[model samples]
Target chain A: MEPILFTLFGAIAVGGALLVVTRKNPMSAALSLIMSLFAVAALFVLRQAHFLAAIQVIVYAGAVVVLFIFVIMLINVPENRLPIEKPTVYRLLGVVAAGLLMIEGGLASRNFSAPATAVGEVGSVEAVGHALFTDYLFAFEVTSVLLLAAVVGATVLAKKKI
Target chain B: MMGPSAYLILSGILFAIGAIGVVARKNALIILMSVELMLNGVNVAFVAVGSYMGDPTGGIFAFMVMTVAAAEAAVGLSILIAIYRLKETIDITELSVLKW
Candidate 1:
């Protein structure tokens, strides 16, 4: 059962990611990215990180991809002028590098084993909230400050003038 | 239960694909998207390991990573917008003003 679920969501995510990279149209790529994000969210559910999964769907697929789509439309680059490059030697090199990395990862994972402890319904929002406030309190506050800075920076950067 | 190895392998493949996309894509927006993909791959690993270890720390870390990723996407797209305004093209290859 677990293996079947993994196969299903894994296929969606990997396939969607491939489409995102290979698609010519930015909008289409954005759509495929959303698909991948959703699949990742599903995988999160399988892992029992229910809260994180919800956040992934809401923040990533809902907000982030929509944001990308808006920017894509705002830029409005003509389809004919889109920066679609033909495959080159550099791209081939990229493929080789990726293949090497994948091979290394697969080899490394062969000996990987889960710890003896069971995860068992421990990733609820309440548990995460407790940890976020207690153990990770400082980091949590820093994240808020970082987000505030990002908001300001984005506005200033996107504005016509300072 | 699916072993951690399966999840780790999937994350690795996703990350590799994302790295390739970053290297091969000339469009700045696509590169940004690829970076997001790489981040997601890392998030998957974090959560998977956390699950395997029976530790909530991994999930919290993944959550933090997601927060950072969102901010990054915002700032990156804004920078892309500024770049487009300046050069009228989002092609990283074409925007070689800083090269010389």
Candidate 2:
């Protein structure tokens, strides 16, 4: 049952992500991205990472996608250009790179074995908070600094008169 | 009885498709969406590995990735809006201002 659920959510997430890239309409693409994010959060739940799952939905599906849609609407991309074309060389290079990446990933997967422990404890928010403050305190502080930098940089870049 | 390998492979395939889309598409918005797809693919792999390894760290990393992705989307969209205001077009070909 667990495997089945995993497979189902995994398929949904991958399929939605593919749709997000393939869809021509920007709005449709954004919607597909939202679906993909939701599916990924579901996978996190299956993995017993409940805290991660909640953050995935709230941060990604709720906030990021909404911002994407807002920008899409604000820009109001004119439909004057039906389809944009890329160089054949670019397409070929993309294919080659993707193929190589998949091959490398597949080879790497063969060497990995499941860990001895079974992850039965749910990754609750409290647990994650405790872990972040205790074992991962330095990393957590660094991430906060990084986030602050991002906020400041974004503000500076978006400022009209600055 | 699908194993972790199956999930990993699926994630890899999805990531590949996203890479293709990013390179093949000429619309900047679409390309950004493709990048998001790639990020999602990575998140899927992270969760799968976390579960299989019996470690919650992977999931925590996945959340961090999501946070980064959100910031990326915000910054990217703001840049797109700035470009659209100046050039009035989102076509990648038209963005040859920096090309020397």
Candidate 3:
């Protein structure tokens, strides 16, 4: 049962991700990205990481991809104006790199051994909160600062006049 | 039956596809979507590892990655909007102002 769910969500994630890349329309692409993110969140849930899955959907698919779609709607991009150049050399290089990466990944995967079972008390929201406050407090604070900087930077960039 | 290795392999393939999309796509928005694909691939790998290792740190890291991805999309789109405003086109080839 778990395996079936994993395969289903994994297929959804991969398929949606491919659609995100293949779609020509920016809105479609953004929507496809949202689908992919949601599928990934589902995968997280299948892995028993409920909090991460919730955060994934809320933060990534909910906020981020919507922002992409919003900006896509704001911009007046004509489909015909897009560059259609077919650079054979670049495509060949990309294929070669992808193949090499797959080979390396397969080789590395051979060494990965799954632990006995998924028994972790730290996956609960309470445990996560404790760790965030105790061990990862500094990193948490830094992330807050980073988010503030990004918000300010985005505002400045979007504004026409200071 | 599927295992952590299967998930990891799928994640790798997805990441590679995203990388190719980023390199091959001409539209900035499409590139951004490809970037999201890559991030999702990483998140899958993170969760899979977390499950296999019996640790929650990987899941937490995936959450962090999501937040960073949001920030990236916000800032990237805003920059794209600014560039579109100035040039009236989002084509990367035409934005070569440094070309002599």
Pick the lDDT winner: 1
Off by over 4 Å in 3: A85-88, B98-100
List model 3 lDDT by residue over A1-162, tens digit each.
878887788788888877876777777877777777787788777777777878888888778877887787777577786656466576667667877888898998888988677467555677667767887788788889889999999999999953
The alpha-carbon deviation from the true structure for residue A110 of candidate 1, after best TM-score superposition, in angstroms, is: 3.3
Which should have the higher DockQ, number 2 or number 3? 3
Model 2, span B1-100: residue lDDT tens: 3467877887898799899889888889889888888887898788778777766677667767876887788778878877777778888888998999
* Count of backbone collisions in candidate 2: 0
Q: How high is the lDDT of residue A32 in model 3?
A: 75
Pick by TM-score: 2 or 3, better one: 3
- Tens-digit lDDT string for candidate 3 (B31-92): 87788888878888888887678776776687677778878988888888888888887767
TM-score on alpha carbons, each prediction: 0.97, 0.91, 0.93
Superposed on the true chain A, the predicted chain A of model 1 yields a TM-score of 0.94
DockQ of predictions, in order shown: 0.78, 0.61, 0.66
lDDT (Cα atoms) of all candidates against the true structure: 0.90, 0.79, 0.79
- Scored by DockQ, the top model is 1
Candidates 1 and 3 compared by TM-score, better number? 1
Worst 10 residues of 1 chain A by lDDT: A114-123
Q: Give the per-residue lDDT digits (tens) of candidate 1, residues B65-84.
A: 89999999999999999988
Using TM-score as the measure, which candidate wins? 1
DockQ of 1: 0.78
List, in order, the clash count of every candidate structure.
Answer: 0, 0, 0
